[model samples]
Target: DAGVTQSPTHLIKTRGQHVTLRCSPISGHKSVSWYQQVLGQGPQFIFQYYEKEERGRGNFPDRFSARQFPNYSSELNVNALLLGDSALYLCASSTNSQGRYEQYFGPGTRLTVT
Candidate 1:
């Protein structure tokens, strides 16, 4: 049983470019969530999807978005990238959407902006 996995372990981008990060959840899991962690700060929740429906969203701007697939995989898309967006983008997966289940996190996709 593998945990969550994220692609492109690292990314380099310019201020206005858009990027899409991918994630695959553990087998049998049905919920996937995204988070942004700036250096020296806690992870900020970006989005959570369960059963292919959006369950929650954080305070992030409209530039941030995500969706879960029928297979329980997910993608996080960030548009109009800014320097401030440079951070470790983490993907977490759980068994349910009630926030009560244990969540497994990925190694994270490190994003760097210039």
Candidate 2:
């Protein structure tokens, strides 16, 4: 079975620019969640999409948004990126069986804002 994966291991952008990060969930998984990990901080939930329906979101500004597709893939978009927005974006996926939350994570896409 394939594990979760993300693209563009690293990126750099100036203030006000926008970026989109991609993620692919493991086979047989229907739940995907997005998280942002800033320097020296734990991963904070950005969005959780199950069956292409949003399940949850965290305390982020309007500049942050995301969506899940039919194929179970997802994309996270950040608009008007700020220096504070520079962080490692992580994508996790897990089975929806009862009491399962030990999500598997992919190497995050690290975004650096100048």
Candidate 3:
């Protein structure tokens, strides 16, 4: 079966622009999450959606948001892009939110701010 998949793979934008990253979870998965990974740092959890509801969020600003669909796919939207926002946006999927199951991650969407 296919794992989590992200679109565009790469993106470029200027400061103050808006960007949307997409993800499609594996088959039969119900929970989707988003993360941001900056160079030399670990991945930071951004949002987690279960059954189309927001379950968790990190310390990111209001400009970051995400949503899951009925099919378990998701989209992460970042507004007012900044140089600091340039990083790899990763999407992960799991069978549940209890952390009992292993989560699978996508290759990630690389965002670059010029």
Q: Best candidate per TM-score, number? A: 2
* Candidate 1 residue-wise lDDT, 44-84, digit = tens: 99999989999999999999989888888999999999999
What are the per-residue Cα lDDT tens digits for candidate 3 across 50-96?
Answer: 99999999999999999888888999999999999999999999986
Model 1, CA-based lDDT: 0.93
Clashing pairs in model 2?
none
* TM-score, every prediction: 0.95, 0.97, 0.96
Backbone clashes counted, model 2: 0
lDDT of 3 at 73: 93
lDDT, candidate 2, equals 0.94
lDDT of 2 by residue, 1-114 (tens): 878999889999999999999999998888999999999999999999999999998998989999999999999999998999999999999888887569999999999999
| Per-candidate total of colliding backbone pairs | 0, 0, 0
Candidate RMSDs in Å, in order, are: 1.4, 0.7, 1.2
Q: Give the Cα error of residue 72 in candidate 3, in Å.
A: 1.2
How does residue 38 of candidate 3 score in lDDT?
A: 100
